[model samples]
Target: MCKPLSDAISQGRVSTEEGERKVWAALEAAISHFIEGGLVTDDLMKQLLPRKYEHWELRSRKPRPSLRVFGRFAMPDVFVGTHVERRDRLGAKWSPQWEHQKLVCEDHWNEAGLPAPFTDQPSFLYERYITSNARQKIRVQL
Candidate 1:
């Protein structure tokens, strides 16, 4: 996990205890899924990571994501938690922390000598609760 994420959780980044719990669960789920070599569904994991650091944003203290967790796969089996953000509501608005976390994650990957831009192939957003045999890959804008 990254410093920002730890800091967020320690500092009570979210407004409600429920939100914090959800964020905590999300981070744990991310780590667990990553360790098992699986992709996290968007409902649980949203990719807000940018390709560069210059585009990062400094977030304000309002209208934040309810259960936000940011990270990237530094390697096939290695997932680095770069940052965590949580609020009373999970809005679809763009998050500055998202980019910042991505930048942190990217830096970690670079220092570790891992390849950047983790995937070159197209990404598919999969359903969250569907079983593997019943799951469907839907091509969507990222």
Candidate 2:
């Protein structure tokens, strides 16, 4: 789980208790599927949908209020969540919050020394593990 995401949930920064519960439930389900070496796709669960921002693949979870987990596949089975943005129903469908997170992820990726995105071809640089079905590997820091 992401620290910021967890902090948001724990701090009750969500819209409502029901929304919070739904987000947590959806997260648990996704984690379970990940642990079972399964891809959490729209087919498996409608909530976990793949979204693209340039070459980055983000996993967005639309709970009651829509909690967006911005991340990219560090590896096929490894999704590193970088930021969490909460969207209340009254807000615009799209927000600059998402763009900000995308920028943060890009900077973090560059800092981490990950392969750079192909500028000419606009191809995914982390596509090497696309076919991998490895079990969920959670990297916990003590």
Candidate 3:
């Protein structure tokens, strides 16, 4: 959560901590970009984000500034924007745009019943960069 990122830099002064906090906050901010307009992610991804960027802002060429959410756990990379991205072995960063297209996005409100898709709206990811549940307060554990 933002608190942990803050605590990571709690020892510093306002300006110092501000920068330090950014380092810690970048991943969370990225996941919360709100571009995909919904929050979603796994636990392991959260760990890798701080590791890769050390809290650096997750910028992009397109720079639409979408909400970042989705720690897939498959890759431990910190990504900003709706598309979760990662650095390849050659050190080139690759946005999981395809993966986003396939894995991200919302489904029907009710799995079995007739309900409208919520894709028109945004999704929310909490402080730890964990996506909120379909109904909120519900953790999706695979």
TM-score of each model, paired residue for residue: 0.45, 0.52, 0.20
Given candidate 3, what's the lDDT at residue 59?
28
23, model 1: CA deviation in Å?
A: 5.4
lDDT string, candidate 3, 1-142, tens digits = 2232233323322445454445335544434553344543332132223233222223221222222332222112223222233222113233455233223311211222323321211222323343333122446699
Measured by TM-score, the strongest candidate is: 2
Candidate 3 similarity to native, TM-score:
0.20
Error of 3 at 80 (Å): 14
CA lDDT of every candidate: 0.46, 0.49, 0.30
Writing each residue's lDDT as its tens digit, candidate 2 over 1-142 gives 4455467556654546766777766755655665576754333322121233433333335565555555555545455554455545224534565455567766665665665432312343233333444322334689
TM-score of 1: 0.45
**Positional deviation of residue 117's Cα in model 1 after best superposition, in angstroms:** 4.8
* Least well predicted 10-residue stretch by lDDT in candidate 1: 51-60
Runs in model 2 with CA error above 4 Å?
9-19, 42-62, 88-95, 107-142
Candidate topping lDDT? 2
